[model samples]
Target: MRPSLTPVPLGVEPMTRSILFEGLFVHGLPRNEAFEAELRQAGFDRGDLLPQYPLRLFRQCMDIACRHFYPGLPVEEGRRKLGHHFVQGFTRTVLGGAVAVGMPLIGPVRFLKKFPEHLRFDTSPILVQAVEVGERSFRMEFRTGVGLSPHFLRGMLEEGLRMTRVNPTLRVVRHSPISFDLHITW
Candidate 1:
């Protein structure tokens, strides 16, 4: 019998925290007072979120914000929006500059091919498996081990492709409680 998997709390890298806050600010959300309240309700505080802390609190805070910001919004839609916002926010960082430098040379296909190496799994639970299906197409599967919602993964993948200068089409080929697969074609 398969052992019961204990859900692990994942860490949010500094870059991710920066992206999330920037995304919230871009959306015109009150990132200070309101966000603090949300964090408190989610069992965390500003102190707890320093740089590289477990993301459970942040995820919980986002969930609360999603409900408040977009009342009656579908979870999937919220995740997608969050994903897009994350990329926008990420683009303003130092790492974004490095990625931009490679845009002209690497292009989206090669970037996606090497995307998995970008994730810092030592601090986070997110894992990615990329399978190249064609010259400019691929299937990327994210395994979060129940730490994150699949819809969020879908959105991140979609926007990441777009940032790579590709007008890619993304389809959710599969989804489950712990993982999801996205088929991307440029």
Candidate 2:
């Protein structure tokens, strides 16, 4: 059966919307009338920052944007590419500067452990945990109540590690309806 497209009332922070549009722009997605229409259909206003938009709205807009930019692209690949763009765009923000200063000293594993402190998940139900498994390896697990795509998370983690100048190897050790595990090594 096709998944329902009913909007879920998840209050995402304004930065999340900013980062998403910035990422789409960086990837050359047209921010034209059709894009605005998608956003509207997803229940967002074009002129206002979506500080409390539904999670489904974000997901629908992202999916539409991806398809518009790259017709016939695989969903997973589109998600990965979008995620990569997200990290690149996000790192230019003020928070990224703070993250950069500590990445070299704390490393990706520990950096991830502290990542949750930066998020404002007042409406979403996503939780992240990082556990060290070896000297240079860690397992980062995400327990998501919302149906976030794993490929997107993988790309974000991969790019995050790369930003730290760490050549990372990532593997999906587990995936279920509610949780996913990523084994990361540098």
Candidate 3:
């Protein structure tokens, strides 16, 4: 993920103890491992959350855990706990938006309100911006540096889809001029 927030000035490390990274920032992400364990114990059915879960949904789940117990986790702590998972999930949402150009809820940002973990305008490498697109679709055009591998990207996508009701036809576009896409299909 591309890091948007520059590290704080010298001796500001303490302020960023919670940053997490998937492929980018790898700094203070959020976490709720204890809550996850409880979820398994409580037999939280995560019915369709098979191999993976959506990043946004994951955020929702994480928030639930935090509210229920891990209140100590601040913004950075939450980001660290979420780490790459959070970034990866949001990345999918970013890419999904471009492809959803024809769909109203394509970006589905409203959905994120309930699932409050994904960062807004993160500098993480997973998402980047170009002037033409402005911040409209940064990751959609970003492809200069190393991009995520298909194998890993697919997994992240699958996980993201599971978290929400993704339109299956929204193919995972990889290895194109742009790295990713959330296109429409019949």
Candidate 4:
């Protein structure tokens, strides 16, 4: 069984962009009544999600998606697959046009250097720090408490770099309640 979510602090409500949900539902998962009902149980109404959603809800939604779509897989593996699909789904959406066009031109090295800034462009109120450790590698540290699995991040980074025509290898070097580090090399 997967561990429960860390409780959000009182009076601090972090939110996520609805575009993320749009990517998940429209591109990653089949949109059906069953999926919609599952989202509702996780405190989201698929049809009603609009400009933004609670960050907690987003995490729960991702977990639910992983469970539904990868029931036979381990939790970590399922979330990783979900993350990989999320990038594919996200880039196909109209809102993700910039990513589709910009990533190829930027290349993996440059893209990794600017990942933190680029992330802010799409998702706000989350803190990520990217440091270039070598010419062909970098370390991304999640500074704020995102609570996202490192395996999931690995999949996302792998797919994002793959879009630039390079395959990236990623691993979790450090993990804690408030932060985590992913070392990525192409």
- RMSD of every candidate to native, in Å, equals 5.1, 6.4, 14.2, 5.5
Give the alpha carbon lDDT tens digit for every residue of 1-186 in model 4.
323434447676767778777777667677777878988877777567678877677778878887778889998788778778878888878867667888888899877877777564233244677888987889897755455567767787888899898978888766576568888888
List the lowest-lDDT window of 10 residues for candidate 1.
Answer: 12-21
Better-scoring candidate (TM-score), 3 or 4:
4
Candidate 2, residue 156: Cα displacement in angstroms equals: 1.0
| Poorest lDDT segment (10 consecutive residues) of candidate 3 | 13-22
lDDT of 2 by residue, 35-133 (tens): 677666676655665444555666776687677765678987787767776777666657665665666787676676776555434456677777788
What TM-score does each of the candidates earn?
0.73, 0.74, 0.26, 0.85
For candidate 3, the per-residue lDDT at 181 reads 40
Model 4 poorest 10 in a row by lDDT: 118-127
Candidate 2: misplaced stretches above 4 Å? 1-33, 45-47, 97-102
User: Global lDDT for candidate 1?
Assistant: 0.64
The parts of candidate 4 lying over 4 Å away from their true place are 1-9, 121-125
Task: Judging by TM-score against the true structure, name the best candidate.
Answer: 4
Pairs in steric clash, model 4 = none
In candidate 2, how many Å is residue 112 off? 2.4
Q: What lDDT is reached at residue 164 by model 2?
A: 69
**Candidate 3 lDDT over residue span 1-186, tens digit each:** 544524324532221112212222211123446555554454332322343223333334445554544367664344333433543534435443453343344343333222223322232224423222222221222232222333333333334433445542223456663265433221
RMSD of 2: 6.4
The all-Cα superposition gives candidate 4 an RMSD in Å to the true structure of 5.5
**Candidate topping lDDT:** 4
